[model samples]
Target: MKLIIAGATGFVAQELIRQSLRHPDIKSVVALARRPVAAPPGAGADGSKLKSVVVKDYDDYPEEVRRELAGADACIWTVAITPSKSKRLPFEEVTRVCQTSTLAALEALHEAGVGRPFRFLYMSGTAAERDQSKTPSWMPEYSLLRGETENRVLAFAAAHSTPSASAPPDFSACVAKAGLITHSYASSLFALGLRLAMGVPSVRLEEVAAAMLQQVTTAHGFEKEPLQNEDLVRIGRRALGEGRA
Candidate 1:
């Protein structure tokens, strides 16, 4: 299946691209980012299956960008600003980066003519609060923003996924609420202290990517709207054991 990896230059996005290149089921990978992306070494020999598409503005999809997205069966969106990054930027910029861009991409991808049951998996954080009425103790503003985005995204796809006079919506969306995706250093004292201080759960990077890959590639599409951190860890561990990338 053709897969699109948005925010291709990110740490998580890069790993996802590396895994996608080696995945037997993924026929082609479209890497979308502000700058050109290069596949990881020793993967995707000659990098023939990977194509890098640069987009200057996520708010607007240019003709070339839209053309590149055509026929894609699924997309893994990893384009949100992290909590730490949000602090350094203005709230307006953060919202545009973390929320507005996502909505735009959803609309653009839907228009890309991806056939029935097209999967769009968003990489969200556990801290994101879906209920706007309640204030989140951690990063309340940011969490609410992300939560709002999640609800909007689900609503957009829900409208299409539900049956209508024309047909069932061709689009579907899933939010993977991962928490503190880390590397080997997760066991380190600093990392441990950080996790304890923030009260955030942690999972390995591989696990997050593996579970996402599985959900998007499954023949029947994802089973639910939100897949929590534990679910991802479980699915990822199994996939890694089976050498499934």
Candidate 2:
């Protein structure tokens, strides 16, 4: 099966790309990003299956980019400005990167056509609240924006769900609401500090990547519409132990 990893340069997406290249089921891996992406080290012989597709802008899908994405089996979207980074730019820019680009890609990919039951896993944060009426206690505006994007993605998929299966192609979308994504390089103290400040649970980077890969590839379908941090931890641990992801 072919898998597309958007925002390939991200720390989490890098891990997913590495794992996907090595996985037996994922025959081809497409790395889509603003800049060129090289197959990560340690992917072994299977690394040859990886291909990088550069896009000048995520919101614009020219013929070249669309052709590369044609007939894709699944896509994991990781593009979004983090809360910390959002503060550096105007909120408009943040929403465009986090929300607009996502919908644009979704529409473009669907228009380009895809394999049956096209699976899309959107990477969202635990703090995001879909209910715009109820403002979150933390980063209310940003959280709401992310949440709104999630709802849009779900709506897009539902429009092409099984009932309308051939709205040309079938569609399914799942959201991964992660918390602090800790990695091996970070000091435990720093990770703990962020968890406390953010007031959200944490999951290892490898675990999140592995869990998401399993969801789109090995699992029957999404384990849940929105896989939470704990769900990611559990599935990732199991996949790692089984040595499949």
Candidate 3:
């Protein structure tokens, strides 16, 4: 399968790319990023199995870049900063970059003749929900905006399908709502404490990527809720073993 990994240089995106290279079912990977990715050590300068599509900015991708998306079976969109880091840029900018750019890219795909059955897996946060209106005051705006984006993307996915001509427009989308904890020192420590004290859940990065990929490749109905970490672990393990995601 031909896959596209958006935000290829991101910590999570990098892991997904590395893993995708090892999957026998994956034929080629298109790594879309603002800057070119350095080939993995031992891989050629051209990145042999990977194609890096560099854009000046996520908000403005050129037509040629859009064309590169043709024939892609799936897209793993892993862009967007955490709420805490979003403050580094204006909230309006963050919202546009995170939400608007996503819409633009999908539209680009359609205009570039990408068939509709294409699966889009968005990396969403756990608290991104229609009912999450009362998150901490400090980040209410960001939370609500993300929630809105999630709703919009889900709606769009439900209306489209791949190889547009062969199937009615019925694109599929899944949101991998990762946990507060990640496979990092700080996050791991916090997850350990939370598990022992507050029963908070955490997941491995590999598991999260695995589950997200499965959601896209399979024909399961659209998922309406944020997938919890434990759910991801289960689905991920199943997916890694070539079972239904």
Which prediction has the highest TM-score against the true structure?
2
- What lDDT does model 2 reach? 0.89
For model 2, how does the per-residue alpha-carbon lDDT over 1-245 read when each residue is reduced to its tens digit? 98999999998999999889878899899999999999887767587888899999899999888998998999999999999999899999999999999999999998898788789999999999999899799989999999999999999998876675324336899999998888866645577887788666888888999999999985477888799999999999998888976
What's each prediction's clash count?
Answer: 1, 0, 11
The better-scoring model by TM-score among 2 and 3 is 2
lDDT per residue (tens digit) for residues 75-175 in model 1: 99999888998999999999999889999998898777775668889899898999999988888999999999999988988876747575434688889
- Model 3: per-residue lDDT, tens digit, 1-245? 78899989987788777777666567788999998985544333234679899988776868789888888888889888788888888988888877998887777766666544677778877656555545644367787777788887777766554445555345677677777647678888888897898665778777787777666655553344457677787887877677331
What lDDT does candidate 2 reach at residue 99? 94
What are the per-model C-alpha RMSD values against the true structure?
A: 2.3, 2.4, 3.8
Given candidate 3, what's the lDDT at residue 68? 87
Candidates' TM-scores? 0.93, 0.94, 0.83
Each model's lDDT comes to: 0.86, 0.89, 0.74
Q: Which residue pairs show collisions in model 1?
A: 160-169
- Best-to-worst ranking by TM-score: 2, 1, 3
TM-score of candidate 2 versus the correct structure, residues matched by position: 0.94
List ranges where model 2 is wrong by over 4 Å. 164-169, 185-187, 194-199
Best by lDDT: 2
